[model samples]
Target: MTAVTKRFGQFTAVDNLSLDVPEGQIIGFLGPNGAGKSTSLRMGLGIMEPDSGSVELFGRAPNVQSLRRVGFLPEERGLYKKMTARDTISHFARLKGLSASDARARADELLEATELGEFSRSRISKLSKGMAQKVQILSTLAHRPDFLILDEPFSGLDPVNQQALENLIRAEHDRGATILFSTHVMEHAERLCDRIVMMARGRKVLDGTLKEAFASLGQGARISVEHGFDLAAALSPKGFEAIRTADVGHGETWRIELPPGREAQDALRAALEAGAPITGFAPEEARLRDVFVSLVGEADAAALEASLAEDGVA
Candidate 1:
């Protein structure tokens, strides 16, 4: 996408967003609700047109012809309630130009692979939310499109199913498919993404490889102690910001920002000199959530974290 923008009435749903999805890489499109993730994806797939700028799929603008090589799963869940799982998947495969027998065979294979074999004959209404989601995903992959665009594929799944989806995504990547998945859950992106593009308030906030994004947060260290100490007198005087202090089990933990000249050992040495009962000490690797909070602010990050917690999508 190059300077693609979208609007609904007076509200700009997507700001001037330009994104490049490298071939064969698993890219994470990340942001909170109303951050324009879905809108940007829709524009990329040509399901919705941008008010300005251009979107290229494969090489040309996305259309029926170009989209034949793409697979998409929208965030919204919808299936024919009266249709059996296998038939629902086969139907979509046929629509994508597969023969009837080929579609049915592919559906059967995918159903078994995703652990939905026993429910192949079950109607959509009879399956659990996770099972139904599996069916929808199978339908999307039945034709084995070269590119995949998944919007919140991990939503509503328990930990086990979410792991299963992660494995499936890896399998697809191994098969040479270019995948872009959108999510508010930071952990998923941290584990599965080769690179990430983050958005906030309808505009692109950050985009880089996982290592590059981590490096952008600078350096830091954490120390977990069994007793209290005067952090202000020790580190604050040395130009370190005490990022957080938390109670853990029978002890407490402190995360301190390290200045450019300092390191983790330097922080540990300072804590030891202060006579704190240190239990654990280590360098603080940058987390996706930390990067997100820094770029988007704490309020939006907290709101998104709360939304994920409510959905049990940790």
Candidate 2:
């Protein structure tokens, strides 16, 4: 996006946002409910145009040639209500400029890859949500496009199916597709993305690798001590911050957020030096979710919701 902005009268759907997507990497575009993620992608897909700024897919304009090289799976579940799973996928491939035979072959292969082999001939309307989701996924990738964009691809799937979806995304990444997707799930971003663009309020709050984005997270490895009360004083002598001391029926747990850059090993030694008996002392760092919440305060969530409910039809 180059100063991309989409507006509906006075409401701005995407506001002067720009982003860079590197080749052969999965970039997680993460945000809260209404953070312009879908709007930006829709503009890029050419289904909707940005009021200003431009979208480039595979270094070309948003025309048939560029679009044919790109695959998009929207957050919404979309498929022909009455088409068979096989035909639904094959039709999309045909639209992408594939010959009928080639389209059918690719659709079959993708359906099998998604474990929907037995349901290949079944009508999409008769399939369960999970199964239908699989067919929708196949439709997007049937052309074997060089770029893949997925919006909330994992939403509404069971753990097993989620893992299956993840594996498929990774396989495409390995085959050299530039995978870009918007997700509310932080763990998926942490695990699958090489880089992340975290947006809040129509602007990026964070954009970088997980390591670079989180380096600012205060140093303190959450460490647990065998004995609660006695450990605080002991650890403090060696300069360990024992922030939380809570009893969970079985034993007392202490959370230590260490000072910035404090080595976990050094902290453990210090705890031991203070004569703190340690049954377990593991350092816990701030997860991606923690960072996201910290970036988008609770107050912004309401406004974000309103932004998403705005019409994108124009």
Candidate 3:
């Protein structure tokens, strides 16, 4: 999509967003709920028309021939409740242009690989929510399309299933399939994506590799000291910038921003030399959530945190 925009009545859901999914790369579309991620994705697939700008799929307009090479799993999931799991997968594969025999074979292969072989003959309504979700995912890839687009694919799954899906994505990539998956969960993106695109309130905020994202925020360390101790005041004269972050039961934690030439060891040395009663310390690892916070500020960061908690991640 190039400078695509979408509006819903008086509201603009996606504003001048441009994105690229390079072949053979795993791209993560990241943002909290209501961040325009779903809208942007719908526009990309030509499911919804953009109010402005343009979209191209497979180097051409999103036509039938080009769409045949793609597989998509929408955020809202539904399966034919009366259909057997195996039949469901085979049906979708057939829709994607596979022969009946090949589709059935692909369904069996996917069922066994996902440990759902015993449930192959079971109807969708007879399966658990998670099991039905797995069936839908398998249906998305049963035809072995060249490109895959999954939106918020991990929301209903437990930790084990989420990890399994990540492995599945990796395996598909190794098979020469390009993937674009959207998620509010930062950890998933951090683990799987070659590059990330973040959105906030309908606008694209950041687009880059993990290294570039972290480098933008520089480096830092977290130090915990006795509750009454003033680590920030003590480190101030030493030219270190420290801010109190949280309160542990026996101590308080302060985040120290390291200067360009400074290191976490230097911060530790400075605290010790200042006669500070330290209880705990560690180099602060940069997280995708932190990058989002830095770009969109505290209010939106709170929303991101809420979204994570809703997904049982926080």
Top-TM-score structure, candidate number: 3
- Write one digit per residue (lDDT tens) for candidate 1, span 23-140: 9999999988778999999999988999998999988988887788888999998999999999999999998989999999999999999888999999999999999998998898
The segments of candidate 3 whose C-alpha lies over 4 angstroms from its true place after superposition are 222-256, 259-281
Model 3 lDDT per residue over 64-107, tens place:
88888999999999999999999999999999999999999999
Which lDDT values do the candidates have, in the order given?
0.87, 0.79, 0.93
- Model 1 scores a C-alpha lDDT of 0.87
- For 1-314, candidate 2 gives per-residue lDDT tens digits of 67788888988878888888888989999876678788888887888988888887667668877887899999888888889999999999999999999999988888887778899899988999888987888899889889999987877776788889899999999888999989776778888999998887667788888876676566555555554446667677666767666764545667775665576778788877777656667766667766766677886654444433441201
C-alpha-based local distance difference test score of model 3? 0.93
Backbone clash total, candidate 2: 4
Ranking by lDDT: 3, 1, 2
Pick the winner on lDDT between candidates 1 and 2: 1
* Residue ranges of candidate 2 with Cα displaced over 4 Å: 224-255, 259-266, 269-279, 301-314
Give the better candidate number (2 or 3) by lDDT: 3
The stretch of ten residues in a row with the least summed lDDT in candidate 2 is 305-314
Root-mean-square deviation of every model: 4.3, 4.7, 4.1
